[model samples]
Every structure is written in C-alpha cells, then in structure tokens.
Target: MSNLAIPKNKRVIGQRELVALTAFMMSLQALAIDAMLPALDEMARELGVAEGNQRQLVVAVFLLSSGVGALLPGSFADRFGRRSVAMFCITSYALLSLVIALIHDFTLLLVIRALQGVLSAGLMVLPATIIRDRYEGDQMARLLSLVGAVFIVVPVLAPSLGQAVLTFAGWRWIFVVLAAMAGMAGFWAWKRLPETLDPLDRQMIELPVVMRNMTHALLNRSAIGYVLGTSLLIGAVFGYVNSSQQLIGEHFGMGTWFPIVFGGTAAMMVLSNLVNSRIVERFGARRVSHTGVLAFIAVSALQVLAAFRHDGDIVYFLPLMATNLALLGFLGANFGSIAMQPFAHIAGAASSIQSFFRTFGAAVVGLFIGQSYDGTARPFAIALLICSVLALLLVLYSEKGRLFRRLNAPAKPETKPGGVY
Candidate 1:
C-alpha cells in the first residue's frame, strides 16, 4: 500500500472515493470555522469576554495558528508521507477540540482553538499536494471542483448543526461533536488513505531551507499576486462567516431559523462550484476565475448600492449575499492551483507558504472588517467589494495583464538561479 503505483490506465482513485475523501478532509476547516458562529455569543457570555469583538478572537486565533502550521506541515508531509501526517494532524486536532469543549476560561479556550487550527492545517495542505501528485491540468481542476462542490455543503449545514446542538445540549456539545467528527475523519484516513509522497523526492526539513523557500514564494510576482488575491477573497468569506449568525438571528429576527437562511445562501456556492467544474475543462481555470472575480465585483457593488438605497433590508440583502458567496467557490480552488503551478518541485513547501498567507492573512483582514458590526450587513458587503477589487487587480497582475489566459500554457524549462520552488 505504501508504494502502490497508480497506473495511468486505471484511475488514481475511484471518482466516488476521491470525492468522499476530499469532501471529508476539506470539511475539517468548514466545520471548525462555521460551527463556531452560532455558539459565539453563548461562549462569549459564558466566558465573560469583555468586548463583543473579542469573541472573534476565538476564530482569529485558530486561523493564526493555521498560518503557523501551514508553513511547516508541507515539509513534514513531503519528508514522511501524506497519509501519516494527515492522520497525526487530525488526531491532534480532535484532542484539541476535546480540550476546547472542557475549557471554562476564555484565554484557555483561545489557546486550545489555536492549537486546533495548527493541527487542522495538515488536512488542508496534504490533500492538495496529494491531488497534485495524482492529477494535473484539467483533470486536477475537475477533481478540485468536485471537492469544492462537496466542501460548500459543510458550511451550509454547519450553522444548522450548531444551532441544533445549541438547542438540545449546549455550545460545549458543538465542540464535543467536532471532536467526534475529527476522530472519525482521522480514523478513516488512517484506514483508507494511501501515502502519495515518494521517499526519493523527500527533502530534509530545515529551518533555513523553509525560510528561503518562503521568501522565494513571497517575492515571486505571480506567487505573491495569487497569494494576495486569494487572501482578499478569503477575507470576504471570513467576514461573512464571522457575522452571518448575528445578522440573521439578531437583525433579521430569524432566531432558530437563522441556519436555514444561512444554509440557503451557502447552497448557491454549490451551484457556483458546479458551474466552475462544467466550464473549467473547456474555458480553463484562469478564464473561469476571471469571470468569477468580475461577477463578484458586480454583485458586491450592487449590494453596496442596495444597502445605501434601502438601509439594509433583508429583501435586498439575501440575494446580494448569496451571489457574493457563490462567486467565492470559483476563486478558492483555482487561485491555489494556479499559484502552485510553478512550484511543483517543492510543492509541499509552496503549499504551506501559500496556505499560510492566504488563510492567516485573510483571517487578519476579515477580523478587522468583522469587528465593525453595526447591526447591519453594510460592513460585510463593503468588505466584499474592497476584497473583490484587490483580488481582481492581483489576478490581472499574476497573469501578466492577461487575466483570461488558459492555465494550460506550456511550461518554460529555464531554471531561475537559486530559486527554491
């Protein structure tokens, strides 16, 4: 099983199994992030968090730790094996979730949550590296799109699940459920997932080497642009996730019905993922992503207009929010794939650095924007607009002013002197 060579004729993984595993792995992040939303107020009250904004620190702390985790896990996965690292990470995360559930104090809870993020980063980075190891070009995009389609459903259901747990048990029970889910996921990976990294390709994990590689990724124009572009897009998403429960429950007078509304909007993202999958083979990732970015800008602009015009009515709010989020599914997968296109040799390191910047950077930006919750959707909409603009600009720059170019362009074989990627 360790050295099972995937034949070109036989599929790397059965489509159904690949979708199932990817969905499960990807859901780790969504469940961790989204399920906490409904419980934020309750947790804050329970812990006596001083500022309403401080509750957001719980989420921010997790993402910040994810950034730290993202940088190093890639090298470990490359050196060891994807399956081993993934199982270890998930087991750690599940244990941390249990710790979070048991914690009574706010500071301790934050520390536990951050550790959970660090552990969860293995799930996030290893899957993409495995996908790359298995597939490339259109096939890779299709696989990612399939995973994206499934991943969207997690967020759709998470808040609803959180609300249900809140109703029957308590907020602590939500973390209990998360711990159970993480344990199950880790067990599945250990039992079913095959190692994809080749021992010959493994590199010595060194601090200087990791730092040098990271600096190369950050300084590379295309990599930098893709990182920033994805970060901004993620920032918008984080802002929404942070505020959705409050807006729907408190402002829109939805209460328990909040998850239904939230889930409904989230379903639209599935539609977007389906659309991306359909067109990615024909039109390619860059074209599809560019169109998505433009659409996001338009949707955000309209939301801003409607907010100013009607003072944030739910009638105008829901549709705009749905459209904005739907567009995110389009940006999420393609940007990472495209960014890593040039860094195949050190895919693990590149993945780690890119994931760190995108997730943690987005968390920082989103936390800042989310703190300005004025009992309206205006701030969220405005943040989306700004992120969209920045993302669009960076995408243009990343593609060397050719935003619509197909991602399948033949690689230039010339090596850059001393470049780590």
Candidate 2:
C-alpha cells in the first residue's frame, strides 16, 4: 500500500507503533552483547578460550558478522518485503543462537556467533527502513528518538538479565533467552507488521546495481561526511561497550555492581533520547546534533583530563560517561536522518549501506581500541575524546560550517496538505 493510502488519523500502528517495533529490533543487538558479558568468564573457562582477548572474540566476531550481514539485507528488504526479510533474519538468528548455546567446542562457538551476527544484519536495517518509509524531518527524528529512548533500556537491563538467568540456570541459558527473544520478534513481525515495501518500488539485489547505488551514496559529499561522522560516533560507543565491564569490574573493583553502573549510564541515554524527542522538532536535528557533539567533546575532554590528573573518581567518571552517552541519543538519530535524507529512491539499500559502514567501521575501530585495554579507563576516555572531535569536524564540514544556523532554521514548507513535517 502507498504511504498515502494510510490515513493520517488512522489510529493504526503508525509512527509510535513503528518506533516501538524498531526499538524492539534494535534491542536485539544490545541484548546479544550485554547478555553475554556476565557469561564470558564461564564460557571461556568451559571452552578454554585461553586469553582474555580471545574471549572478546565471541563479541567481536558477532559485530564483524553484523557488518557483513548489513551490506546485503537492505537490498533484500528492497527486493522482498520488510516484514518478510525481518522474519527470515530473526529466524536464522534464533537458530544460530541455538547452535551457540548447544556447542561445546570454542571454534564452533565462534563460528556460530559470527553466523548470528550475519543474521542480525536484517534486524539492524529493516526497522529503520520501515520508519523511513513513513516519515521525514522532525517526525522522523521524533520517531527515531522515541525508538532510541526505548532501545536504551535493553542495555541497562541486559547484564542483570544475563546474571539472573546465569544464577538460576547456566551460561548457555543466556543464548536460550536470546533465542526466545528472537523468536518473539519474529512472531511479532509475522502478526502485527504489514509489508511496507510497495511491489512497484522494489529493486532487484544485484552486485552491479548494489555497487552503483553505494557509489552514488558515497559520491554525495553530505551523505559521505554524515556516514563517516556517524560511524565515528558509533565507534566511540562500541569501544565503551567493549571495555565497560573490565573497567568497572577490574579497575573500579565493582564486580557485583557492574550491572548497576552500566545500567545507570544507559539510563542517561534513555533520558537524553526522551529529551531529544521533545526538542528536535523545535530546534531541528542539525542544531541538536551539533550541540550534542560539542557536549560529548567537552565531556570526553574532561574525562581525559581527569584521567591524567589522578582524579579518575567513579563519581566523576560515571557522570561524565553518562553525559557523553546521553549526547549519543541526539547524534544517532540526526546523523542517520541526514545520511538518508538524499536517498528516497533506494531507502532500503541506503539504510543497509549506511548500517554496514556505521556498524562495521565502528566495530573495527572499537575492537582495535578495546584491545589496547590496560586495566584502566584511560584508553576508553581518550578514544571517546578523539572520536567526538572527529565527529564534530565531520559535522561541521558536512553542514558547510553552518551547523548551528541550519539546526535553528524554520521547518521546510510542507510539500503536501496534512503531511507530517
């Protein structure tokens, strides 16, 4: 059905429902990572992963697979239906999770984790494409922020959820829980979700066409800058995720309270996204994102300074990290919209390619920085500062040095009567 066929006032699963679903889908990514953290030591011990760094492979392998998976799912979504593609991905992911859970050999576990990542690629891109199919500008931003707000809750509770499952059962139960979640998501899509892709608008998934579309997307200077900027932003967060447990557990001596600290910081992200939902319409995405990048830079800089000054107190560190994370709520939604603004023709492929770079690039950078861990938060702090600075520069360049001015500008005139701007 054409988006126009859906009535503006039709109280169906509109933007809010779409956001809720997207949030659920995005939460899968977080759950996959955080839920495994508490189980890492046990899994390592059972599988004989040898070194601490080797244990990280379980996480890194998934991320790597996610990136590679991201590259093709968008094209598939465009050619097929969003709901169908999503169901397929989730089903595959659930099967992979089952494999990861039942396997005893370490190499098999790593291979399963990688396959799980590949399956998750569809989960990452389809929700955004579905949302993009229906909204733009402030409406899109608000929807994304709402989803972002809801998605943050996953990370906040994931570790504790994992711990609870572990306490009751065993480490393998974590994957079992993940399988249940994926199965639930698949059923949700099958039941409540409609096919968002119109048959006439569908594009074939071919290498030449994929390359051409990607090249076109890259050739657009604004899109390129935004993509790179968003990748760096994601890189910072990924680095933090990779290092957070060790930093809190080993360095801060908060092994038991690690979930509390991590969850608290994640809560800040939820709060910030809530705020972004309210203000992004008035202040504009560009303005909000620019300000957020600046705030992140300031917070990251302070973290680095504190680290050097021997004042790396948890009280100070947590607050700073929270502030930095909160800004990501703004950056994540805005950067995504900006990168996608010019590609309405191939929204699915555009979303896929954007996700590929954002997830894959961030994973690579994050893994590199995470490997440099030396039982201190300094590496994470320094990495955050560097990423923020780079993101700011890219945003500035993308906006033609008019980042603040463009953000505060009046909304573009509506193109159609009763259209949500």
Candidate 3:
C-alpha cells in the first residue's frame, strides 16, 4: 500500500503546503540560533559576562537543553496528536522568547534559554515525525531534502535579519522578532497542519509501552548507526555555529560584514539541499550521503591545513568551510530518512529517540568543539574531519561494510482492522 494512503480527512492539504508548513516549523529553531549570532557580544556585555568565549554559552545552553528536550514531545505526539504537541511547543517557544527578552541576570537567561530549548525541542522533532507519518524511503529523503532546502533559508538570512534588528532596535528586539515569527508559523500550523498519526497506530502513554517502543527504536541496527553518524555530523555543524561569530566577526575581522559573510556561507547549504532534492530520487539516500561524507572529510582536511597558515587567508578558508557545510546538506536529510525507514508503526517515538541522540550527543560534541576555540580555526577544522571519519565508520557498520547500496527494505508492513500484515 502507498504510504500516502492517508485518509482524505487526514491528508488535509497539498504537497506544497505540507512542505512549506513543515519547513517553517523547523526553521523556527534555526532562526532562534542563527539570528542571535550578531547579538551575542552585546548580550554578553549587558549580562556582565567577563570572558569573551563565554558568550557562546547562550547558544550552547539552548542546544544542550534542546537535546534533553527532544525526548519528551514525540511520545506525547504519539499519544495525543502531532498537532496539539506542535501548537504547545510553538506557543511556549514564543512566550519564552518574550520572557527571555526581559531577563536581566545572565544565569536567569541561561535557565530560561534551557527551558525554551526543552519546549522547543518539539519544533525539531515533530516536523520530521509529521513527514514520516506520510512518506518513506527515497521518496521520504527527497521530501525531507525539499523541506531542508526551504528550512536552510532561515540560516542563510537569519544572521542578516538579526543584524538588521541589532542595527536599529537593539538586541532584545531580536527576541521579539523570533516571537513574532513563531506566532506566524504557529498560526499557520494551527489552521492547516493535519493530525498525521492514524488512530490505529497511536501508542498508549503508559510508561512500559513507551519504553518498549523507545527500546525498539534504540535497538534497531541501521537506525542507531545512521542516528549516531548524523549526530557527529550535526555536532560538526553546531561547532561552527557556536564559533562562527567569533571566528568571522572577531578573529578574521569581518566585524559588521559578518552577517553577509556568514549568510554567504550558509547559502551553500541552501544550494546543496536544493540540488539533493532534485537528485535523491534517482541516486538513493545512501549513495548520495556516503559520497557527501567522503567529500566532507576531504574538505575538512583542506580547512585544517589552511587554518595552520600564517596568514590563514580568508579566501581559502571561506570556500573550504562553505563546501564542508554544503556537504552536510546532502547528509542530513538522507541520514534522517534512512534512520527512520524501519519504524512506520512508531514514527513518533522513533523520531523522538533519534532526535534525542542527534541533538543531545551533538550538543556535547559541539560544546567541546566550541570551547576548544583558541582564536584559531584549527580546532573547528580538526573536529570536522574527526566527526566525518567517525560518521563514515558508523555508516559502514550500518551498511555492514557496504556503501552506495540501496536499502531495499520497506517499513514494516501494517495491518488494518480488515487487512492482514
């Protein structure tokens, strides 16, 4: 049966609307992170922070909490519905933004940011869950790539948008802008997002049942391998995000031009995803993503060599770094879709579990990378290569030493009341 064999009522919208809405929902997280880059210095200053590197904590703490937060919402979405959990997350994210804007103490701000991340974890998990509820395999990878193509726009533009706000209304207004954007996405979601979980597939909220489901998700060999692989890759990306402002705006001295340079690099992500969206259906997720992993390792090596140069020419650094990020565009959606290929019955729990590993593990790894910054790009570059190599090893394990082979398995077949499994 077609995965798209959703009931007419549940398939409430067209493909374009579904992609747009999901992308917007996911982009909120990106906006919250990337848009705050330019404001970190001022935020640190007003909050009376002394060390320059400590400013990275504002983003780091949010990411750490977000990792922990990923564990909750999916189980609820599985029990209640995707829409309700999603709306709750969006509303809370907006409110938290407002609350954080008014916070004076740095500790208080970090606490609030952590709370916001916990709630906002749904923003990351639910969209993928929602997509999984409707698609699978390479088709799923293509759709996710399309969603990523749209979602990457937030990162491309967010630093610039934040800089614009910082130029006029000050940094606090950046939170206001985030609140407004969340409100908008939430409104659209409230009105248009369908409950994708079929009633028959709904899992109970009981602890044992939830644990069993999560255990199944965790134990799946392919899923865990891909999940860990993506986590390392995601950590590498977050490492860059954690130090982007410092590296580009401060060390390389782009200063006010940081946004443009950052956005330009981010634009590579947008382009890569767009290209992946177009070709993934033909080449398969494993082939595309494995190739990307190799290229990422190669590029990271170049980045490291460039970092050691006396001049550390921005000319060489920017392109290599951008290429590495662009490679991630191919890996992210494909790895996620492949990890999710086996869990049609427990999409929500599986997504939640996978998201927890991907986000939480990445957060820890990213923190290490960020804190390792020594006013040189060497640490970040080395982290990228190490992550890519480790990711390739995990992928090899998942594929049992194979690469570029298709995952011929479909999701476990379902049995409706009148049908057989």
Candidate 4:
C-alpha cells in the first residue's frame, strides 16, 4: 500500500539517479572502513603497533568520532542546506585522507582517521534526511533497502580491492585512492545533486533549538527504542568488521584468501538487501524486518554453540558468522526507517541523532569485543549473540511487544516538553 501520508506534491528526482548518488555518498563510510581491512596488520607492523586488537582502534576511533560529529550535521544541514553540508564533508574527507597518507606516526594517523570520520558524518547521517525528505513509510524503507544494496557493494568489493592495491602499493596508497574517490563524489554532488530541503522548512542552527530537538528524539518512545535496538546490531557489525581479518586471516589461516572469503561473506548483506527490497512492499517493513531480527538472534545463538562444539574451526565458524552478518541487512534499513519516521519534519536532526547514538553504541561495544579477541572466534560469537538478544528486546519495546505484525501507521513523535520551537 502506498503511504497516504507522503505529500503528493514533493519534488521528483529520478529514482535511478537519486539512488545512485545517495548510495555512492553513503558508501564513503563503508569504503573508508572496509578498504583498510586487508592492510591493517601490515600498517600495524610498519607503525609499531604491538597489540593486534589495538589496530581495531583505527576503525573504532573513526566510528566514535563520526557519531560525535553527527551532532553537528543535522542543524547545519537544516540551516545551510544538505548539498552544501555534504560538499564540505566530502571535500574535508578527501583532504584528510591525503593528510593521513602523509602522517608517519601511528598516533597521529589515528587522530587524523578520527577527524576524517567527523567529516564523514555528513555523508553517513544526511542520506537518511535526504530520503525522508522525499519518501515515507514502506516507500521509504524500500528505497533505503535499494540504496543499501548498492551501498553494500563497497564492503563486498573493498577487501579484494584493498588486497589488489596492497599488491601494487603500500597501505598508505589506500588513502590516495580514498582521497581520489571523495574528490570525485564531491564533484558529483556539487554539479548534479539539488538541494532537497525546502527554504521554508529550514531552521536556524541554534543551541537551544538543537537541545530541544535532541530531547524530543530521546523522549519519543518508538524512536528511541528503534535507535537503541539498531545501535546494538551496529555494535555487532562493528565487532565483526574490527576482527574479521584476525579471525579469517590469522586464526583460520586464510592469509592470502582473506579478502576473497571476507568479500564473499559481506556479499551476503547485499543479497539480503536485494531480497528485502523485493518483499518489503508486500510484507511490510515491520513484519519482514522483525522476522529478520528474530532470525538474527537465533542464528547468533546457534553460532555460539557452534563455536563451542567446533572450537572455532573455520569451516563451521566462517559460514555462521557470514549468515549472521547477512541478517543485518534486514534489521538496519528498517530500524533506521522506523526510527526516523517520527521526525520527518526535522529529518536532518533526526538522522544525526540516530546515527550518533548508533555509531556511538557500535564503537563502544565493538571495542569491548575486539579487545577480547584471543586467537579465536568465541568472543566474537558470544558478542553477536548478546547484542542480537538485546536488540530483540529493544525491538519488542519499540513495537510495544508486537513482533511480525504490520504497524497500522507511523507514530508521531511527542514534542519537547516546552512550547518552544
């Protein structure tokens, strides 16, 4: 059923063009993180990193910084317009990647990575606002799934691409490619993408206004629940991303084939999104995604048992991990759509808050799981199970105990306590 609530008069952008641009913009986050996976160990050694787990700080710190930086994008996007904000972010991202290439010190490199992540917030957080600006309900969910399917190709290709680059150049050259890609994306946005936020809807970027918006998001029951649930799942994905090289390459002895195996597994997420796009319109985002979350929990729990029985043998471990990761496609796009639904009028702020909390949650939980790595997949398996269950509970709370049922309509978020703004 079409969402009757979607305004009939919204400006139309070509679906193909919109999807491609938004997906490309969103893929920056995936590319920045995934492309470096194969090179982490080599980079770690060259940079004098002793602990393998600490290498994850490169990933975790970036995510953490991006989440924090997300606090800035929404209001600014509301004030200055989405296109301008995105351009600044893409340009900064390109320049920082160059700076990272020049930095020889590991600590300084990490600090630069963190800063790059902050700039990355515009790309990561604003896509949802752009989409919400144009669509609502299942239409919104379906579009997001399609864009995610496209965005996911980055993670799918990045490992192998990184390896290929590693063959020809050192890891530092990876930053060169990142810089070049961002430059291209910035150019694309500047030339082709039109501003989606209407001038009438723009808000002044003010401290009091931001605080009120933030408070409304936190107090809104459904939005906050979905945000919390999504955060747990993000944490699980981050934990896996942070440790996949160690588990597959170092632990399973895949060494040279690490990229292939990792790429193949990440491809499952792409497949999941494709499947989601096909079914969500008919089944409803809630039913399809709720079922997906349940399946994720069950699969994660089974993986824990498999780790116990198989003792982290790659044959049993890798497939289980891949299967669990695939389920993420279902939960992520839907959870994000649901969480942002109540804030359609303030999409930028809503997107920023959701991304900030989710990324923050992912970083903290991922660091804990990564630091627990002990030459095995057990810690990772257990972490997935725990995160999945917590996410399920949060979903239940968000849905008011309903699972697999289609929601009647989107709930309007409760306004801030004050009559202000």
Candidate 5:
C-alpha cells in the first residue's frame, strides 16, 4: 500500500482579497505607531516630559510591551482559533485607545499604551500564522511581499494624517484615529476574514505540548538564525523610527514637512515591495533578500561616510535613507516567510517566538540606538552597519556555510529553509 496526502477543507478566497485583508490586519500595529508620531511633540509638552529624548518613550514603551505581549497570542491562536483571538485583540486595542484619550498623566498613558500593545498583538502576530496556514514555499514569499505593499501605506499616510488631526483638534484625536483604524479592520475581519487554521492542524492546549513546541522551534538552527538576523534588521528600523522626529524635525529643520519627506521615503518602500512581489519567484527568497542585505550594508557605510564629511545636504541623506528603506522593504517579507516555512504543525507558537525575538530584541537594541542620538547621523549609520553584518552572519549560519544557493528543488530532496530536523 502507498501513502499519499489529502488537502484540508479550506475556505477559498481570491488572492487579491486575501492580500488586502492580511495587509490591513498587519497594518494595525503600524497604524498604532505611525499615527501618533506627528503628535509626539505636543504630547510631550502637555504630558510634562522633562527631557527631549524622553519623548521617544511614546513609541518605545509600546513596542517593548508588544514584544512581551506577543509571547502568548500565538499559542492562543493555535488552541482557540486565529479569527477569535484577532477579534479579541482588536476589541481590546480599541478599548485601550479610549482610555488613552482620557488620561492626563504621562506615566499612566505609557502604561496603558503598553497594555494595548499586548492586546493588539493578535492583529500583529496572527496574520503571519494565517499566511503560513494557507501557503508555503515561493508562493508564500510572493504573497507576503504583496501584503507588504498594503502594509507600507499606513506609514506613508499616518504621520500626515496625525498632523492633520493635530492641526485643528487635540492630540487625543490621534488615538481616536488609531482606534478607528482598528475598528475598521476589525469590522472587515469580522465580516469577511475566514478562519484559516483547520481543525486537524489545531494544537491541544497542553503544557507538555507547549514546552515541546518551544524547544523544537528554538533548537532549530535555521529558524533561530533567521529570527536573530531579522531581529537586528528590525531593530535598525525601530531605531530610525524612534529617532526620526529628532533627526528630521529638530536637526534638519523639516518640522512641518516631516510627513512629506517621511511619506515619500516610505512610498519608495511600497514600490520596492511591489517589484519584489513580481520577481521573487524567479530569484527565490534567499537570492533576493541576500542581495537586499548587501545593498543595505553599502548604503549604511555611505550614510556614515556622508555624515562625517558634511559634504552633502538633504541631497545626500535623502537618497541613501530611501535606498536603505527600500532594501528593508525587500528583506521583511522574504525573511519572515522563510523563517516560518518550517513550523506548519505549530505555526502559531513558531510565529509567536519569532515575533517575540524580532520585536523585543530589536526594541532593546533600538532603544540604545535612539538614546545614542546626538544631533548626528553617526549612531544611526553605525547601528545599520552593525545590524546588517550580524544579520548576514546569521544568514550564513542558517545556510550551513552556504550563501545565495538555491534552497528548494522539488524532485531532489534538500534541507529546507525553515525545515526542522
């Protein structure tokens, strides 16, 4: 007798709808962060923040809590279901926003924001698990890259939108906007988003099984390597986000125009991911992502050199930053899909662990980078190089001493990108 496999009963939907839905779900976290950015200065002023740098805590604390908060949702999604946990997260996130709008004290606001990050994680982490449940291989990478196209829209518009809200209304309205984004996404999800995890694929809520899954995910070299590598890259992004206002507004005097400059750079990333979606099948994730990493390193070095020379103005800095950001757009989707490739059986736990490391570890390093800001781009530039180098080293480890080699051959077996031993 020969054994073959059977496909699970999945609720089929068009690819465009899935991409749009997943992109909206993933954008919830970005909306939470970016939508408040333009209001940070006024927020600091009203909240009585003592130092200029301390203003960054507005973004930092939420991300820290988000990292810690992500540890559980993946397991919950595994045991309960993806849609329920996501809806719960959206509701909790909206409620917390309501609280944040009413709070007057800075300390209390930070605490609530952290809690919201914990609850909002379902919107952040579950999308990855949902994608993993539905697709694998190059198809998964391609879908994720398309999803990135949608994800990039929030950053491009959020700062400007927040500024518009702050222009006439109170800063509190910004949180209201964040809440609105969540509510809209939640409503759409409720109406249209089908449950992706099949009954057979669901994991039992058992202590022993949780331990086994965690151990397996951590011990896998390729998975951990990808997790660590992506963490550094993500940290670079967080670092920039943390210090962007100070760099662009305070240092460069692009205060009101910060949104246009920031949005323009972000739009470049949107275009890059769109291009990646088309070419990823021909080049494979490793080839495309590795090339982006190399490009990132070169840009980082150039950024550092330009910073020291003082030879260039926005002409020099803008293009380098745009190029670096575009390359990052290339890395995020491919790296994530590659890392999650191995953990189909425990996709939720795996997604959680990977996100925990990527989110928390990057936040820690990003905090340091943000704090290191001193009216110079040197710190940001150095952090970028360090992150890129470390990520490349991990990529080498994940590849078992190989670089840019073809990972999948359908007919002939090979050790897979995220495959567990």
Candidate 6:
C-alpha cells in the first residue's frame, strides 16, 4: 500500500538519492555533536574549564539553542521555500565552524556554538519537513527509519574521527574538519535538493499566522503526546552522549579505546533501524514502537540493577547499555512520523514546532542527566528507566490507553492537484 502511494514524477531526485541526501543532511547534526565527544577533555583543559561536568556545556548548549532555533526556519521555509532556507542555514553552519576553530576563550566558544546551533538547526528540521512534503504515515516512518539507519553511521564513526584528529592535529582542528564537511553537504544540497514546499500549501510568515499554525500543531492530541514521549527518549540518549566519554574512558579505564567502545554501542542502532525499516510497514509504526518501548523498559530495568551492583563491570554494562540505546532506533522515526500525521498541510511549521519541543526537551533533560554524573553509571541508568517509563505513559495517553493497535485512518496528504505530496 505504501509502495503504491509513492509520489511519481514529483521528485527531482530519485528515491535512493533522496533518502541518502536526507540521511546525510540529518547526519550533520550527529557528526557535530559526536565528533566533539573525544575532544571534550582536551577542549576543557585548553579553555580553562576546571570542573569536569562543565565540559558538557559544549554539547548541551548547542543542543539547547538548536531547539530554540528550530522555530524560525520552518516558517521561513513555509513562506519562501525549503531549498533557500536550507542553503542559508548550511552555509552559516560552515562559517560558524570556521569561527569556532579560531576562538580561544571558553565562554566565547560556547556563545558561538550556541549561535551556530541556532543557525544550523534548520539542517535537522528541514529534512523531515521535506520528507513530509513527499510522504506521510507508515510509509513516512519506513523512509525515516531508512534515514536513521544511514544517520547512525556518523555516530558509529564520529568519535573515532575525533580521536584521530586529537591524536594528530589537536582538538581545534576538529572544527576545521566540521567546516569542511558542512561545505561539502551544503554544496550537495545546492546542486540536488529541490524546493519541497508546494506554493498552495505555503503559509504567511506573519507572527499571527505562524502562531496559529504552531498552536494547531501543538494542540493536536495525538501529536503532542508522541512529541513529548519521543522527546524524553531522545533526551536520555543525549544524556548518554554527554557523559559517555568520561564514563567509558576515565571511569572504565578504557581511555584509548573510548571511541571504539562508544562507536560499537552506536553501531547497534544502525542494525535496529535497518530492521525497523524492513518491518514497520507490515506491523505498523504503533505496534513496532510499542513493542520496542516495552522491551526498552525491560532492558532499562536491568541496566538500573547492573548500575546498582557498583561492580563497575564493563563486560555486563556495555551490552545491556547498547541494547537499551538500540531500542531508540525503533522509537524515534515512528514516533516522529505518527506525530506529524495530522499536519500535512503545514509540514514546515509543524515540523519546526515539533522539532523545537523534541530537541529542547531532550537538551534540558540530557543536561541534567549529564551534570548528575558521579563517576558511575547509576545516574545514567536511573535516568534511562525514568525516561522509558514516562515515555510509555505518554504513548498510552496518545493512544487513549491502547498499546499495540494500529492507526486505521491514516492521514491523507493535503497537497493541491498536480502538486507534490
């Protein structure tokens, strides 16, 4: 059914190209964050950050600002077009990376990172909005999962890349590499990415119109519940990323192998997302994600138990943590697709608003979890369990207490006649 619904002759790019491009564009966010993980300690020392937990601000501040910045690009995209806004954001991101590479002051670096995050957030928001311009419902979930499978490659390799840079060229050059990558991505987008916003569906950029559209998207019962739920899940993941270097490298005595260990855990998500893309259409996004959430809670419970043992045994901790993180592959794309179901007409504004909540919520929760790190995994474990359980409740609320039932009335695209859906 989803296969038959493909928007034929509408895309300037092929399906495979679209998926790969969107995934690479999305991967930029991951690369920006993850590539800095291995270098955080070095960055801390150079920037005069004496406290250990403060280093997390480098990542956390960017995430927080990205969330806040997510609100603008969508409305602009809705007014102008996705391609123009995306191009502007990508170029700004590269330029900011260049600036950060030259900065010496810790506060100055963080300020630029925050600003960069705001500008670059469109890189995260626009891809999903573009996908929504082309597809929705379970088919959208499948495509997003495919995107996730590819995006996970960055997390798998970014830490190692950071480590290699740190080994040879020092931490500041990490930003130089980021600038180069962003330039490449921006160039690809310029050459190949199409304007996905149909003229008929475009909204005015006036404050009132933007607010109304944003309010409508947020007020939708099904959408907000899933939005909040997914936020918590991703928040927990960000928390892990925040403290992962210290946890794996310093506390576990795996200093040199941190990238390999971190990347190995991230690799699990690649497999899970691949499986999700394959099965999501058959089982439905709700059932697959619901099952995944339940399994997540179970694994999270064991993680809490493992952390409580105070054994500090990497052998037991690594696999359990990896499994728990992998479950996000099942939840993220499905939850996002479901939340965007009723907003086909205002995909840009809706995507931006939802992205704001998701990213902002995750950033706050993750910052707390990251700062709560006590040279042990207990804080992380407890936070994951709490997030998973709350997520289940939110999912239940979204479905009116139902768990595994599929959504029968899938949303129809509101595109005009002869326009891309």
Q: Give the better candidate number (1 or 2) by TM-score.
A: 2
State, as a TM-score between 0 and 1, how close model 4 is to the true structure.
0.86
**Number of colliding residue pairs in model 3:** 0
TM-score of each: 0.84, 0.87, 0.87, 0.86, 0.86, 0.86
Cα RMSDs, all models:
4.1, 4.7, 3.7, 3.6, 4.3, 3.9
For model 3, the stretches where C-alpha displacement exceeds 4 angstroms are 1-11, 37-58, 101-109, 166-172, 244-258, 302-311, 373-379, 408-421
Of 1 and 2, which scores higher on lDDT? 2
> How much does candidate 1 score in TM-score?
0.84
Question: What digit string (tens of lDDT, one per residue) describes model 4 on residues 1-421?
Answer: 3322333333445767777888999888888888898899999999999997999888778867887899989878877778889999998999999999888899999999999988778898888888887677777888899998999888777777789999999999998999999988888887777777766556666787877777777657777888888888888877887788898899889999987898788888899988888888788888888898889988988888987888747888878778887888887888888888777556787788888888778778887888888988889889898988888888888878888877666555444333233
TM-score (C-alpha) between model 3 and the true structure? 0.87
lDDT per residue for candidate 2 within 161-239, as digits (tens), equals 9999989998999998999998888777777787766565567566777776666655566777888988888888878
| Candidate 6 Cα errors over 4 Å, as ranges | 1-11, 36-58, 102-109, 165-173, 245-257, 308-311, 373-379, 412-421
Pairs of residues clashing in candidate 6: 133-421
Better of 3 and 4 by TM-score: 3
Candidate that beats the other on TM-score, 1 or 6, i.e. the better one: 6
> All models: lDDT?
0.77, 0.78, 0.86, 0.82, 0.80, 0.86
- Please provide, for model 5 over 389-413, each residue's C-alpha lDDT reduced to its tens digit, 9 standing for 90 to 100: 9998898898887877656752121
How much is the lDDT of residue 198 in candidate 3? 78
lDDT of 1 by residue, 1-421 (tens): 0112332332245656866886898798879888878899999999998698999888777867777888878878766767778888888878888888889999889878887887778777877777766665555666688788988788777878899999998799998898899888877776667666655446566776667666765667776787899898888887887787787788777889986797788788788888887877788777878898999999999988887787647888888888887888787777776776665456677778888888778888878877978997778778889989988888878778887777455344223224232
- Per-residue lDDT value at 26 in model 6: 80
Off by over 4 Å in 2: 1-12, 45-53, 245-257, 371-382, 405-421
Residue-level lDDT tens digits of model 6 in 358-414: 987987888899999999999999999999999999988888899898866766643
